[model samples]
Target: MIPSVPTLHSERFRLRPLVRDDARALFPTLGDPQQCLYLTRPAFGSEEELWGWLAEPGWNGRTWIAEDGEGEVVARVVAVPTDDPEVEEIGYITCAHRQGEGIARECTAALLAYLLGEEGKREVIAEVDAENIASIRLLDRLGFHRSALHIAFEETHKGVCDVAIYTLSRER
Candidate 1:
């Protein structure tokens, strides 16, 4: 059986499935260094990779494209299931031109609400680069308290770097 798609909306943005048609709008944002500072990989070389990543199978995870009121995609948000069914990892990135507009925060909050409230997900985890203060602050505002710091969880494009893990539980 196919997993259900989630369409989440916030006051200023709409979070919908990351479709093939969004490649043109998404590539620029994913390719921008400033927008992907905390990401594990550098800019995606092709739209095919982006599409493939979104279409991959997972029971408790999904990717969403954030669009503004005028229907322009400004960012991407994702909730990926881990080995444990009760835990889901969340991450997001906004286009360079759209930073500081609260788009990431809005999209992330919507995703958290959908996962915890409707999907019954127990916990949401996020691994952010230690230097990415903006994302750290955003996660905190969304009720994700820091659970670990300066941990080497994965080998990223920037070599071995410290990351901070934050978690928001359903009980909170």
Candidate 2:
């Protein structure tokens, strides 16, 4: 059975499923232009936009939010299925001011452990803009291998660009 979204405890934060109430705490990081520079989609322009995004269905996967003890949102992670149920796609977004602080790594590790260990996923996938070096490095640190780059995968801060796909298998 699929497990219910559970609160995960990391050394510095508590990770829980993303909820609508998190909109205010997450906007600064999610809307920062510098942070969204290589994102596939444009930076959120308003709280309304962020809310719309947070409210959208996850395409059948889980979305987690990492918060400090004071309840400030520090990072976000998501693992959603692609066309194949055994393969899941993961996403991470750290607040702008919190970048370079290892928040993404902490949150993603927690999410992956649950998804691959308890959930029985065969692989975890991530598609990032080719110019997104930060994300590429994070995936590498997490043991993901480069799969392929799709031509003109999506429009981004650099205009239409190739998307690099990375994957990590359970056996690895």
Candidate 3:
């Protein structure tokens, strides 16, 4: 199993674990259809459902909540282990109201460092919906290059969608 999640830090945000109370605070954005459009799962129907997901104990990865100075959750990040010991897959979701504020970039950069340094992962990859231009741009800014190998399409709750893979190596 992955080691206990640790609190990470950035210039303007603190990345830590989610609390029960955070489910309520994040429901608005996480439950919104627009925010879940590119996700494999559909928008959560209620705060309780989102809470249940957060409460799951057998998570195969590490997760963190990016909180601003005021302690509000601005975004969530997850890094899942893959078959290759040197690699991990990552994902992030930003609160709707907090988009375009550089929170994702800063917090995710910290996450990348932790994964590559402390976690001993040599490479990190992110899989995003092909149509998610914003996320694709973010991955690019983070120095993740689009991998030639990608899913042509996958049938998910959102119907068939093209998926793209991006990767960042520790040496870079």
Best by lDDT: 3
lDDT (tens digit, per residue) of candidate 1 on 1-172: 3346678889988888877888778777776665665688787777777666556655456678899999999988888878888888988888778888888988888888998999898999998898888888999999999999876756877778888989999999
Q: What local distance difference test score does each model get?
A: 0.82, 0.84, 0.89
Each model's TM-score, in the order given? 0.88, 0.90, 0.95
Report the Cα lDDT for residue 111, model 2: 84
Worst 10 residues of 1 by lDDT: 51-60
Which residue pairs collide, candidate 1? none
Put down candidate 3 lDDT per residue, 101-167, tens digits, no spaces: 9888898999999999998899999988998999999999999999854565788787888899899
Q: In angstroms, give how far residue 146 of model 1 lies from its true place.
A: 1.0
**Ranking, TM-score, top scorer first:** 3, 2, 1
Question: Regarding TM-score, does 2 or 3 come out ahead?
Answer: 3
Off by over 4 Å in 2: 1-3, 57-59
Model 1 CA lDDT for position 147: 94
Cα lDDT tens digits for candidate 2, 1-172 = 3346788888888998778878887888678777778766677898889988877754566678899888888888887777888888999888877788998988898888988988888999998888888899999999999999899878765688988999999999
Sorting all predicted structures by lDDT, with the top scorer first, yields 3, 2, 1
- Higher-TM-score candidate among 1 and 2? 2
